[model samples]
Target: MAITDKFSSKQIFKFLPIVAIIIAGINAYYTVNEGHVGVIKRFGEAKDQQPPGLHFKIPFIETVEMIEVRTRKNAEKMASSTKEQMPVTIEVSVNWTVEKEAALDLFKRYGGLSQFEQRILDPRFRSATKDTIPQFEAEQLIQDRASAIQGIERRLTEEMAGFPVIVDNIQIENIILPAKYISSIEIKQTEKNLAAAEEHKLERQRFKAMQAVNTADAEAQSILKVAEADAQAILLKGRAEAQAIEAKAKALKNNPLIVKLTEAQAWDGKLPATMLGSGTMPIMDLRNSQEKGN
Candidate 1:
């Protein structure tokens, strides 16, 4: 029994150093997750920065803090007013990331990400949004919303200068206005639409009137042309009749016997029904034979 006890005590003393070495090895190394960086601190002072994956540190002397370097979102809702003193509620979201080069500075200044946001980012974002909202009217906010968003983003980015976090994007998620104001705008727009429709109706009426006047003028011109043509035809016909009468009168003046010849052409070869006493026969060449020779 004494021989067995001596052998167990010797084996136990030999494994003590091995057990301590394994425990120390386990406490010396740490792993940083994907998209995360580790910051090393020695005796509560920032010492060095480490990238993702396995890293070694002095156990119980140096501490490692894992900071997510990936993009993070911070959203806020604020109540503000327009230039017209119209109350509005706006929701804004900011996308940010810790700068790898400035991680140690960030850790030193704010002590952590939460403290950085609370001390710097959130307050500046609220201030920027408040300052911008008062510069715009309610209508301008609705009409030129994109410009409003840009102004807020510019101001926020400007405020974040020299900070350890990078401002990737700023978005205005929602803008809420008073219900009464929206109803008034809708009413005004409806009136404008009605006025535009009325103006369009008047234009159509004017166009129709112009078309009717043009049609009447064209009809008048057609009638005048037809009357002129008919008058010209009548004048030509009267002139032709006068010319025929003048030609007949000229032929009679040239030969007086043409009238007797024309009358004999129209006479019948029969005796008269009755004759007066000592009256010569009608249209007869009753001259004597000696007179005819002279």
Candidate 2:
């Protein structure tokens, strides 16, 4: 009986610590921080979610699973650009969050925030990248990269629909092509530049030709003006000579002294042997002397 009593006391002492530990754990409450949500699980399955606050759950049978409630970013690089299989490196990031309404179900299926990338998110990203990028050409993808990234986002969004993951954005970083194609493009551009230069030279020649034509026309006009002036001067000189002769004829026909002088001006229709205006007094020449001697 003494040994049984000693064993009972020892058992009671062990039982007291167990009871205290149970009470303390059951009454404990924890506060959820920013960008986090608390999921209360019963027997390893999610039963309820607690918002950002200090909350309690049955400690022995219930456990709280902490999950990130904020949006998350994931980056992926695609190996090649779709059409030509040119080597390309794509840096793509997606912004995602767990939907508030589906938090419990999501936690139940996916376990925790740590299981997200492998189980639910990364596969969707890979699938979307493979399917969407293959439909686009390498050059077109490089030029319209934004549209390509947007298409990836849309595809992932569609694929992840009805799930707790909400994809916000996707991006494509860089695409690289071969140097041979770039060199070919440069050569073509240089040829076009040479052709443009030749055209400009021809245009300058045409302008110079037009200028030469104008210069010739101006010179011709100046020569014509000089010829016209010479013609007018010749006409005026002819008129003056003719008018002087006419005035002299009219004076000789009206005046007797002038008629006598004009009649004596002729000597057998030859040049005069005696001077007509050389002497101040009357000096009889051949015709008057001959008439007097007769």
Which residue pairs does candidate 2 place in steric collision? none
Q: How many residue pairs collide in each prediction?
A: 0, 0
Each candidate's TM vs. the true structure?
0.67, 0.57
lDDT scores in order: 0.89, 0.80
- The per-prediction CA RMSD against the true structure, in angstroms, equals 7.5, 9.7
Among all candidates shown, the one with the greatest lDDT = 1
lDDT of 2 at 283: 53
lDDT of candidate 2 vs native?
A: 0.80
Q: Which has the greatest TM-score?
A: 1
Query: Which 10 consecutive residues of model 2 have the lowest summed lDDT?
Result: 266-275
